[model samples]
Target chain A: MDDILLMLPGPTTVHPRVLNAMSQAVVNHRSKRYGEILTETNELMSKMFQTENQSYLITGSGTAVMEAGISNVLNAGEKVLNVVGGKFGERFKKIADAHGIKTQELAVEWGTAVTPEQIKEALDADESIKAVSVVHNETSTGVAAPIKEIGKVMKNYDALYIVDTVSSLCGDEVDVDKYNIDVCVTGSQKCIAAPPGMAAITYSDDAWAACENVDSHTFYLDMKAYRKSGNKDPAETPYTPSVSLTYAMNEALKMIDEEGLDKRVARHHKAANATVAAAKALGLELFADEKVSSATVTALKIPEGLTDSDFRGTIRDEFGVELAGGQDHLKGNVFRIGHMGNISYKELFQTFAAMGIYLERNGIVEDGAAGVSSLVKSYL
Target chain B: MDDILLMLPGPTTVHPRVLNAMSQAVVNHRSKRYGEILTETNELMSKMFQTENQSYLITGSGTAVMEAGISNVLNAGEKVLNVVGGKFGERFKKIADAHGIKTQELAVEWGTAVTPEQIKEALDADESIKAVSVVHNETSTGVAAPIKEIGKVMKNYDALYIVDTVSSLCGDEVDVDKYNIDVCVTGSQKCIAAPPGMAAITYSDDAWAACENVDSHTFYLDMKAYRKSGNKDPAETPYTPSVSLTYAMNEALKMIDEEGLDKRVARHHKAANATVAAAKALGLELFADEKVSSATVTALKIPEGLTDSDFRGTIRDEFGVELAGGQDHLKGNVFRIGHMGNISYKELFQTFAAMGIYLERNGIVEDGAAGVSSLVKSYL
Candidate 1:
C-alpha cells in the first residue's frame, strides 16, 4: 500500500519509532518489570496532564475512560450539567443517561464553545448538580473550550469538574491542576501518537472521595479497582493492559519528553495556524469559530460546487492524503484536517499541497499554489 | 533484554508475523478499508468460534468482554447461576454482582470440573435463573469444563448459556454452535497469539432477544450499539477500535487458518500431554484432575521443599523461561505452564530442560533429565 498521510482528528500519523515499539514482544502484565513500565508510563502521563493526581491506564478506547470518568464519580439519580457543544460534549450526557444519572443539558452552538459565565449560571441555577462535564477540545467541530477560565468560575461552586482532553492533551495547553479538573481523560491514539486501544485517566482527591458515595455500575472500568491495583508495590493496572500498545505509548511519551512538551505544543499550534492560513488563502471558510479554533484539528467548510466525497476522495486516491469528513450533523458540509502528534511542517505542506490542487481542479480557487504558499509563509 | 519465553496461560508467546503486523500504520476506523478489515476479522473470529452467530471485536481485555457478556443480556435483579470452579469462573459472579444482577453460586472443587448433572440439578431447583455462566477453561486451575454435556443440559432449560473461552478458544475444542452457547467470549492474546487489548464475543438469537429486555448499564460495551454498527455495509465497531491490535489479530487469525484449527488443537493437546507426562516423570503431582486438565495450560503442585518463587524464579532469571504462579489461595503452592498459541516442540523441550535443571538444583528429583526424557517419549 502507498504511504497515505493521515490527516484525521485521531489515529493521527504516528512516528516510525512509536510504531516500531508496538512490535516488541508481549510481557507478563503481573511481572515486576511490566509493573515498572506501567509505573513509568503513568508518571509520564501524569506529567503530560500537569496534575498531581496519578494517572490510570485503561485497555480500551478513549470512550471507555470517558465513561469511567463519569460512572466512577457520580451515582444514579445525581444531576450533572453537561456542556454539549459538539459530538463528544454530548457524549458525556449520553453516558450519564446510560448510567441512569440525570443530566441538565447546557447546549451551545456546534462550532462555538461554552462560556464560563454560562457554566456558572447553570451551576448557580441548580444546587443539586453534582458535577460539570466539558470537552476541552471538541474534535467534531474543531473548537477548543476555555477550560482555565472556566476553572476559575468553578472554584466558587462545589460541583466536580470533569474534562475530556482526548484530542488536545499533548498537542494543546492542558493544565489539569490549574483547570481544577476533578477527572481528566485522554486516549493514546490522539496527541500521544500511540496506537489505539489504550487510554489514561487522572482523578483528583475530590473525585476519589465522591467515588465513595457512588455505587459504580461498571466492573472493567471501576476506578476504585484501578486505584487499588495501581497502589501495589511496583504499580499495576487492575486488569491485563494492552501490552504492545503500552510499549508504543511509552515510546511516544519518551519522544514527547525528548522533544519537550512546550516545543511540541508550539509545533502543533504552528501546524494549526498554518492550516487556518492555508484555508483562508484557498478562499475557504473554517467550520469552527476563529476565536475558539482548536490547536489539534482545523475544520473547513466544503467549497461550493463540490461534494464531500468527491473532494476528499480525489485528495486521497489521487494525491494519497486522507482527510476526515465531518461527522454527524456536519457531515457532507465540512472536512477536518488533523495536525496533532508527530505531524511536522513537511506533512502539513503535503496536506495543503494536495488540498490546493483539489481546490484548483474544482475551480474553487484561482491558483493551485495558494495554500502551500500560505503554509510556507507561516512556518518561515 | 533476553528473549524470554512467555508461558503464561493467556498472554502466550506471540509470533513474529503477528508482532510485525502491529507495526503497520494505523488507518481510520471509520473508513471503508478499515470496515472491510473489521468485516474480515469478525468473519475469521466467527469461523474460529465455529458459530453462525456473528462475532464482535471489543477493544479491551477479556475481562471487559466478560463484563459485557453479563451486563448486556441480563438486567439488574435478574438471577444467574454462576458455576465457580476457578478464579475466572468466579469473575462472572463478581461482574453480575457489580451490575446488581443476582447470582446463585454453584461452587465446585478448584481442580475439578462442574458436571452437567450438577448444572441440571441447579437449574431444576431455580426456575427464576435467567442465565448460566461457565468458564470453558479455568486458567487458575487448569481444568476444562465439559461444555458439550453442559450444553445438552442447557437445552432442557430456558436459561441462556454464557461461556468464557479466553484461554482455550482456538487452542482447545470450542464448538460454540454444538455447545448451544448463547454467548461466547475470548481474548486475543491467548490461543489467537495476538497482542492483548482485543477480545471477541458471539451472541445467539436468544441472547439478542434477552438484550432487548435488559437495560444495558454499559455504554462502551453495549451489544446493541455493536450489532447496529456491525450490520452496516462493510461492518464496523461502535467505538474506535484498537487499529494496530486489529491488524495483529488479522495476521494471527490468518496464521490459525493456515495451520488449520484441528491441527492447532491437536498440537496444544500434545504439548499439554507432554508437560503432564514430564511432571509425572519428575515425581511432581498435577494440580488439576487429569481427566479435566486443560489443553492450553498445565498446573503442577510445587515440590514439597521448593518454594513457588524459588522454582519459577530460577527458570525466569537463569533460563529466561517465564511461567505463571498460582493465584489467590493457591499462591506459592502451584505453578502453571502455558502451552498455547504458536508453542512448538522446540519451546516445549526448552521448557522441560529448564524445569529439569531447576529440579536437580533443588534436589527434588535425582535425575535432571527425567522431564525432558518424558517429553521426548511422548512426542515420539
Candidate 2:
C-alpha cells in the first residue's frame, strides 16, 4: 500500500529521520548511551515546552500522562474545577472522576473557547477547589482556550493550575512559567513530529508537593518515582520505557531544534491559515470561532449534501490523504484538517486539492479547480 | 557509535526488519488498516502465549501490564499469594502492596526455582487467598519456575492463576491453557525481539469475571475499557497506543512465524546451553540451579577477583556487548548473559569470546581462547 499522508490531530506525520531512528537496535535501558538519550530527550522536551522545570517521558499515550497529571496532584475527594469546551474538556472531568477527584464542571458551548472570567468565578464560588484543569487545545473542536489569561486568574487563587497541551504544545506558543502552569502535559505524536508511544510531562514544585501528600498512586505512572530516576546523573526511567519511541522522539526533537520553535510555530500558523482560507473559499463554514481556532487542527462544518464518511472516505480512498473526522457528538456534522507536525504548505495545498476533488466528485462543488487555485493562492 | 549487542534479559536485539517496520508512516488509530494491524498483532500474541483467550496490547512497559494483570483480578483488601524467588518475584509483592492488595509472600532462596509443592502448600494454608502471582522466569537469578506443575496445583483452589513471563514467554514454552493461567503477561522487548513500549496480556474468562466484580480501576490501565475498544469492528485502543512499537512487533511476530515456534525455542535453548557451557569452561560457576536455569538469560557468579561492574563494563566497552549485571541483592555478585529473541549462535559465540577476554584481562581465567573454543564446540 502507498504511504497515506496523516493529517490527524495525532499521531502526526513523523519525520523520515525520526522514523528511521525508531528502527535502531534496542539498547539497555540502564546503559550510559540510553541514559544520555533519555536526558537529552527530556532536555529537549523542556525547551519545547518552554520551561526550566523538569520534564519526564512516560511510555504511554498522552491520555496516560493526562491521567498522571491529574491523579498525582488532585487527591481523592478533593474538589477540582474543570473548564470544558469540547470533547477533551469532558475527558478531563472523566479522568478526574475516575481518580475519585470531585469536580465542578464549567462547561461552555462546544466549538467555543472558555474565558478566564468563568474560571475565576468558579474559583471564587468554591474556595475549597484544590485544582483547575483546562485543555489548551480541544482537538475535537479545534478550539484553543486562553490559557495565559486563565493562568493569571489561577495565580490569585491557591488552586494548582494544570493544562493539557497535548495537541497545541509545539505548534503554538505555550510559556509554562509565564502561565503559572503547575502541570503541563503533552504527547510525542502531536506537534513534536514523532510516532505515538510516549507523553512528556513537566511539573512545578507545587504539583510535586501535592503528589507528596497523596497516600496512594498508580505505581506504573508514579510521577515522584519518575522525577527522582529521571534526574539521576544519567537520566533513566523508573521502569523500562519504550526505547524505540524514545529514539524516535530524540530525532523528532532534533528536527524541532533545527527548525527553531518560532519558525515552527510560524510555519504551523501559516499552514493553518491557508487551510482555513481554502475551506472558506470552498464555501465551507469554519466550525470553530475564527479567533480561537487552533493553529494545529482546523474544524470545518460538513456540506449539506455530503455525509462525513463519504467525504472523508473519498479523500482517503481516492487521494490517499487521511483527514480526521469529528469525534463523538460532532461526528458526521464536522470534519477536521490537521496542519501540525511535519506537514508543510505543499501538503496542505495537496490536501486541499484532494478535498476539492472529493467535493466535485460528490456533486457538492461545481469546479474542483477553483478550490485548488484558492488553496494555492492562500498558501502564497 | 556502533550498535551494542544487547545481551540483557530484555530490550534484546531487535531484528532489522522489525526496526525498519517502525519507520513506516504513521496510520490513524481508528483506521481499518490500523485495526488490521491491531487484530493481527493480537492474534499473533495469542499464538505466542499459546492461549485461546483474548490478548491485549498496552502502551507502557511490561511492568505496566504486570500491574494491570494483578490489579484487574485482585480487589483491594483481597489476599493473594506471591511466589518470590528473585527480584521480579519480589516486585509482584510490591505491586500488589501498591494496589492495596494483601499478599502472602512465598519466598524461595534466590537462584533457586519455586516448586509446585511449595505453592500447593501455601494455597492449602490460605483458603482466603483470591489469586496467586508468580514469575515464570526470575530474570535476576536466571531461574524458571515450575509453572506447569504449579498451574495444576492452582486448579484445586478458587484463586485466579497469574504468570509473569516477561523474560521467558517466547524463548521458553508456556502453554496458558495447559498451565491453566488466568492472566499471562509478557513484554515486547524480550523474546518477541521488538523494541520496548508495549506489554501483551492474555486473560481467561475467570479473570474477566473477577474484573467484573471490581469497582474503581486506574483509568489509563483499565482492562475492561481496553478489551471493549480493542475488540471493536475497527479495533482501537481506548487511548492512543505506541503505534511505532506495534509495527515493530508485527514485523517481529512475522519473523517468529517464519521461523516456527519450535525452532525459535530450540535456538534459544541451544544458545543458553552454549553460554552456560562456555562459562563453566572458563571456570565461572552458574548462579541458578542447572535444572531450572532459564533458556533466555543465564546468570553466572562473579569470580572472587573480579567485580561485576569491571567484568561487565569491560565486555561492554571493549567488545561492544552489553551484558546485564545482577539486580538488587545479587548486584556485584553475579552477571547475566541473555540469549533470547534475534540473537544468533554466532553472536553468542562472539559474546563468549568477549567474556573470555574480560576474564583473562581480570586474571580470573587463564588462556581466554580455551573458553571461546569450548563455546564453539558446544554450539557444534
Candidate 3:
C-alpha cells in the first residue's frame, strides 16, 4: 500500500517519461506508422549496440533472449563453453545444460571475476567448444567480467563470445563494437529506465551466420524464422510485437541520446563512488573485489551483529526500500543495492539514512553516528 | 492522429480498461500479487481451453507460440500430421517442417472447410504420425475450420491434435476440453483485447504427457520449464514475465466474465452474418465457403473492376478505413475485414458504409445505397 523504492538490479526505477509513454492510445500493430516505429527503433538500437549488424528486439525478458541466443542456432550435439562465476554465469550453464548442449565450464570463485586467460585456457582445452558465454555484469556479486579481454581471447580461438550484459549495458560503458561480441543482450528495465517488457539483442553477422548453420529447428525462438518473416515486408516481426512496450523503449532511448552516453556513464560512476564511499565510512565491508565491482549493483556484507535477511527485511517492511538479497551460496551473507536507471544522490542518501535508522533501532549498529558521518559524506 | 478502428485479425483492438491496467506501476514479478495473478490467469485460461490442464503465458506474438509449440516439444525425427486449409494452416505446416518434423499433410482448398473424413482417412493411412496440427480460425482467408468435428476424429486416432486458436479463442467459442484438444493457443490482442505482448497456451494432460515423454531441450519456451518454475513457486515462472501485460489481461478477463462467454460469442456470430450479408448486397462475393466462414475476419473477392490493392488503398486513404489485403499467392485477389476484439455495431456498420463509399468512388459499385441498406437490415 505504501510507496516502495526499488534498489534491486532490474526492473529498476522506471522514469516518469517512460511510464507516460505507455499512456498513449494503443495502436494497430500492422499499420505503416507502427512499422516506421519498428524500423526507426532498429536503427537506434544499432547505434546503442555500436554495431551495424542487425539487432533483434524480442518482447520477452532477458532470459528469453538468452534462450533464443543459444537454441536458435546451435545444434543439439554442439558444445558451449560457459564462464561460471555467480548467478547469471550459473544461469547460462544451466540453460545450456537444459538444452542438452554439452557444456565446458571455467568456474570462478563466487566473489571473484573470471579472467580472459581462463576463457582462453578452456577454449584451448576443448576444441569442440563452439561458443564462449559469459555475463558482462553479474548482479549476484557485483562483478563485471572483462568482456574486451574475453572477446580477444575468443577471437584467437575461433569461438563466439556471447555476453549477458543485462545488468551492465548502459550502466557502465559497454564498448560492444570494440569488444567484438557475437551476441550482446540486455533487458529494458535496467539502465534504460523503462518498464520491462522487451529484451534487445544485437547479433554480429557471424552470429547470424551461426543461426543460419544451426540445425536445432526451433520454432518460437528461431532467429531464422524471425529473420525470414520480418525482413519480407513492412518492418514487422514474424510475430506480433508489443507496440506499447516499444513506445516506452523509444522514449527511453531518446532520453539516453539527449543526455549523451558519456554523461550517462559518468553519472553512474559518480553514484557508485558516492555509495561505496558511504559504505566504507560506515565500516561496512564491500562484498565484491573493488576493481570489478559493478556500477549498477553494489553487494555489501552484513555487519558483525546483523543477519542479511533480517537487516533487509526490516528495511523493506519499515522504510519501504526493496533491496535484493544474495542468491545461492551468498544467501543471508550479502545484500545488493542497485543504483541503476534513474537514481540520484538524494535517493542513495535517503537509503543510507534509512539503513542507519533500522540498524540503530534494532541495536545492530552503535547508535546515530552512521547517519551523521556515513550518510552525509555520500552527498559531499 | 484521429481515432481509428483496428480491423486486423490478431492485433485487433485493445480495450481501454486493459490499456489502463498496463499503464499502472509494474509489480515485482516475484511478488505475492504477481504469483496469484499468474496462477489465476492460467486457471482462467484453462477455462477458455475447456481443459483442466495447466497452460503457460508467454511474452511474444502468436508466431512465438507456434514456434515454441513445435521446437520445444517434438524431436528432430518426429512425425506430425498437418491439415492445411488456409493461410494460418499453411503457416503451421511450415513451422512444423522447419522443426524437421516428418509431416503428413491433408491439403484442403483455401477458403474451404476440411472434413472429419479426411482426417480419419489420413490417420487410418499414416499410423506413424505423432501429432496432428490445424488452425481453429484462419485469419487470412476468413475460414474457421470445424475444430469440434476435427477433435472427434482425432480422438479416435493415435495422434494428439494441436489447434492454433489465435483469432477465435475469446471471440467465438472454444471448449478445448470438450473438443479433446491437445494444444490450444491464442494471442493477447485478439478477443481478449489486451495489447500484443503475450501469447496464451493450454496443454491437455495428454499433451503434457507427450511433452514429458518427448525429448525437449529448448530452455526458455519449454512448457516443462515453465511448469517446473511456475509450479515450484506458486507465483513465479522460470523467467521474468511481462508484468504490465499480465495486469492488462487480468482486467480484460474481468470484462469477459461480466459479458458472459455465450453472449460474447453470439455477438461475433451476429457481426459475421452482418458483414457477409452486406458484402453480398454490394455485389461482392464472400471469399470463404459459407459454412466455414469465420466470425472474425471476412475475406471478400475484389469486384471484377477493382484490384485488391486499389480498393484497400481507397478505403484507407479516402475514408480512413484500413483493410487487409491478401498475402503470398492470394495477393490482389481479396481483402479482409476483421470484426473481432472490442468492436461495437456502430464501428462495424461504419466500416461497411466506408467500404461502400470506397467501392462507389472506385466505380466498382453503382451506388452506396445497397451496401448501407444491407448492413442496417442485417443488424435488425
Give the per-residue lDDT digits (tens) of candidate 3, residues A236-345.
Answer: 77667898888888888888888887788888888887778777766678999998888888999987778876888788888888888888888888888989878877
Top lDDT model: 1
True contacts kept of 1: 0.81
- Runs in model 1 lying further than 4 Å from the true structure: none
* lDDT of predicted model 1: 0.92
Off by over 4 Å in 2: none
Ranking by lDDT: 1, 2, 3
Specify the highest-DockQ model's number: 1
- lDDT per residue for candidate 3 within B270-335, as digits (tens), equals 888888888888888998999889998899888787776677776777767767888667788888
Model 1, span B56-125: residue lDDT tens: 9999999999999989999899999999999999899999999999999999999999999999999998
User: DockQ, per-model, please?
Assistant: 0.81, 0.76, 0.57
Q: What is the lDDT of residue A183 in candidate 3?
A: 84
> Global lDDT of each model?
0.92, 0.88, 0.79
Task: Give the count of colliding residue pairs in each prediction.
Answer: 0, 0, 6
Q: Give the per-residue lDDT of model 1 (tens digit) for A190-240.
A: 898887889999999999999999888899999999999998978888888
Model 3: share of native contacts present? 0.59
Compared with the true structure, what per-residue lDDT tens digits does model 2 show for residues A189-246?
9998798989999999889889899855588888988988998989999999998889
Rank by DockQ, highest first: 1, 2, 3
TM-score sort, best first: 1, 2, 3
